[model samples]
Target: MRARILSVKVGHVTGLREQKKQATRAALGAAALRLAWERGPENVRVDDIAEAAGVSTRTYNNYFSSREQAIVAAVIADRESRVAAAVVGRDADVGLGEAVIDAVAGQYEDEGGRDALLMITGSPALRACYIDTVAAIEDPLAEAIVERCPGVDTLTAQVLSAGVGAAVKVALRQWLRPTSMPGFVMVSGSVTDLLRTALTPLRPALEAAGDTEVSRCRL
Candidate 1:
């Protein structure tokens, strides 16, 4: 589990084996996403994902309980890559406004990043599963928020976390839908305009939040 691994990294030794396991798990996830794309998530199978990843079905079982978990893994992996990139660019010198601008704008610039949005938008079951994942993230998210924003209540943290999660996702969903022409350019403009209006009060913080560098705990 992510929680256990974090605890271990705090004290327990990290080993090559653990690293390999993580790599294999990631491969399995990529495989699952590929299958989901090829044939809707509902039709995708655990064995198919495992075979695509070139790992055994048993290994797949060890890592994920079902195809949905693998979809979750793919979503999580994309987020990890984005956050890792964001942290690299983040600094105390950057104003919250610019950060927010960057975060919101990055959604438009990253053409490759639309896959998750497309997957969620295209599949009803995956969308529901993603909602469940959002619900489950409260505990860990609140813990992280407490560390960053001292004096916050865990309950409030959870609510804030889930609200933000829902907002970002809804924003993406609206953007992805064809109410507008073309893909991201229109989507980007609309989301930017909507977000700009919605978070006008905390524009700077929102801009800072907009930076793709923090967490996809939302989308």
Candidate 2:
């Protein structure tokens, strides 16, 4: 009974610690985004972001490597994980390319994502940061890809995931550019359409993965 009680107490403590960390991370990301929106990414400093987040400068560094990461965190918070979940939850019959494109587009279908997309499109610094941050989704995506392509090597899964990430970045750039309008205005076409078009090149690879999965199942 005592050991069980002790285990429960330890679990509670760990959960609380995680909650605190998540709260601090969210606060920092929100502050960074707000500051960057109002004053531009170039003008925002780590101290300023920390103060805005109601945390110490050291705490800010503990969470993010740079101001760019902190600022972009607001835009990307929980999104990569969500994408991986979406990809994994998709029907087994669904093509991997279609699943990935749909999952990626699904992230931007909301009104809430509009402002962040606008800000990223408008600011050169933020755009660069956004492009780089897309790569962070690769690890989670690789996990999902591995699940679908169990017969393939880990390196193959990683490469396919990285390729998907690159396609997303390219599609976003293509969609955001040539708009001939300000950031506040809506860009043409659905993000889904852009992602589908950009990711079309990966259909062959995804088909191969599906074939591999089918072969493994047969075996």
Candidate 3:
């Protein structure tokens, strides 16, 4: 009983710590975005964001690597996990490919509107950071694929998720391509459409994995 109680107390403490960290991260991201929007990304320094968030510069460093990353985080906060959750939460009847593509496109469909999109695209540094964020989807997405397809091996799931990440990166890159004009980028097409087109090639692989027999494969 004492061991169980101690374990429970420890878990509670750990949960509280995680919550506090998330709150701090959110605060910092919000401050970074607000500052960037108001003063431009180039003018918003790490010190400025930290001071706005009421945390030390050291604390800000612990959460984010750059002002651009923090600003992007505010625009797409917890999006990676939400993508995975959406994939997992889909009805069993839905094809794995459709579910994944829909989840990704839907989550990103309304991210921050025209102002935020323009701000991110106008700066090369911010555009690079934004593109890099797509990689974060792999781990959670791998888990979701495995859950949705019990026969899928860890390695296979990881590979598929990596493919998905790659596709998303391509889509984002195309959508945010730079124009001939300096510091100007054209929004070429709808991001959702680009994502769908990019991901469509992977549908067969996803469906095959989903249809894999448990007897023929090891999870």
Candidate 4:
């Protein structure tokens, strides 16, 4: 009982630390975005961001290594709230693929909308930062899939998630470039179509095989 009490105390301490960290990160991110919006990405400096966030420039450095990272933190914050709360049991009917589509569409629709799309197509800094963010998005989707699909096994879930993540990134990259369709429809159709076209028959077949394997194990 004493050991259990100790463990609980440790867990509480850890949670407090995480909460503080998240608060700091959010403040810094807000400062960066405010500065970026006011002066554009190029004019914003780390000191300006630190001042706006009410943190020391050193604290800003500790949270984000660069001005670009500050921008990224802002981008992620804007996107995260919109990401469908479909991680595992939050919405059992929502498959990871569909959930991902919903989440990404939200990002594409926000402040990083059509105009940001055009800017990203040309801006080297935005491009580099987006590439990094895509990888981060991919990892979480992978874990979410494993959590959502019981008996899916780790390796298989990881591989499937990776393929889905890659497809989403590719579609996002394409959509980020063109304004071909009537506003939002362009990306929605393009991304879903791209994934469907690329993985059509192969994906279904693999899924069936996986199901059979799982069933056999159960038997």
Candidate 5:
């Protein structure tokens, strides 16, 4: 009884710690975005964001490596987990490729709005960070893939998720192309369409993995 009670206490403490960390991270990201929006991305410093979030600069560093990442995090808050959850929540009859593409496109289509998108595209550093954020979907998406397709191996799921990330980056680059004007980007066409097109080529691999049979699984 004592061991069980101790385990419960430990779990509660861990959950509380995680909640506090998440709150701090959200506060920092919000402060970063507000400061960047009010005083251009170039003018917003790490110290400024930390001060606004009521945390020490050292605490900010513990959460994000750069001001741009923190700012981007505000726009992309929980997107990775949401995308994974959407994919996992799809019907069992849905193909893995279709589910993944739909979930990614759906989440990204509603990400922030014109103002936030323009803010990210206006600054080269922020644009790079935004593109890099697509990679964050890999681990969670891989787990979702494994859950949705029982016969799939971890390595296969990981490769598929990485491929999806690469496709997303390509689509984002095409959508956020630079123009002749300095410090300005020309966003072209529909991002959802671009994402679907970029991800289409990976459908075969994804479907194959999803259809893998336990008897045919490699050692």
Candidate 6:
């Protein structure tokens, strides 16, 4: 009875710690974005972000590698987390290609997504950071892919996820380029169309790896 009570107490403490850490991280990212929007990326300093987040510069460094990463994190908000959740919530029978494509493309179907895209595309530095930020999705996505297809190896899942990341990078570069008129010109079609087209080459890999039979055979 004593051990059980202690265990519950420990679990509660750990949960609270995790929540606090997440709050700090979110605060730093939000501060970074707010500063960047007000002063532009080139002018926003690490100290400024730290001050706005109500933490020391050292604490800010603990959360992000650089100011750009923090800004990108703020810009992305929780969309990557949403993508992973969406993928995880899908029916087990859904093919990897369909699951991933839909999860990513579905994010852009909302008004908030459109605003993020416009904000990101308007600045070259932020756009580049946006492209780089997609890499953050690889690990969680690979884990989710492997969970849905347990027969698939971790390495294979990682490779497929990397391919997906690369496709997104390429597609965004094409879709967010600047025009002579100034500001970002939306490329000719929907971002969803561009993403799907970019992702088309990975269909074979996604299908084969996601197939239970193929996964088992390779194992």
User: Which candidate comes out best when scored by TM-score?
Assistant: 3
Error of 3 at 60 (Å): 0.5
Worst window of 10 by summed lDDT in candidate 4: 210-219
Across 1-219, the per-residue lDDT of candidate 6 in tens digits comes to: 999999999999999999999999999998887887788777889999999989999999898878888887876777777777777778766777888888877765642456556666677777777778888888888887877777889999899989998998888878776688865566657877888999988988888887758565221
Winning candidate number (lDDT): 5
For model 3, residues 1-219, the per-residue Cα lDDT tens digits are 999999999999999999999999999999999999889899999999999999999999999999999999998889999999999889867878788889888888878777888888889999999999999999999998888777788999999999999999999999999899998988987899999999999999987787667613222
lDDT of each: 0.57, 0.79, 0.90, 0.60, 0.90, 0.80
- Which residue runs of candidate 3 sit more than 4 Å off their true CA positions? 215-219
TM-score of each: 0.55, 0.79, 0.95, 0.72, 0.94, 0.82
- Residue 154 local lDDT, model 6: 93
Model 2: lDDT equals 0.79
Q: For every model in order, what is the number of clashing pairs?
A: 9, 0, 0, 0, 0, 0
Q: How do the residues 119-164 of candidate 1 rate in per-residue lDDT, one tens digit apiece? A: 6656556555654553443444445444433444566556554554
- Compose the digit string of candidate 4's lDDT tens values, residues 1-219: 999999999999999999998898989888886787778878889999999988899988898888877776776663533432444434544444545545444454444455554444455576567656655555565555555555666676567656655665666565554454432223444444554554443355334423554523211
Candidate 5: which stretches are off by over 4 Å?
215-219
Model 6 off-target regions past 4 Å?
1-13, 110-113, 178-188, 214-219
Question: On a 0 to 100 scale, what is the lDDT of residue 58 in model 1?
Answer: 95
lDDT of 5 at 89: 90
Better-scoring candidate (lDDT), 2 or 3: 3
Pairs of colliding residues, candidate 2: none
Better of 3 and 4 by TM-score: 3
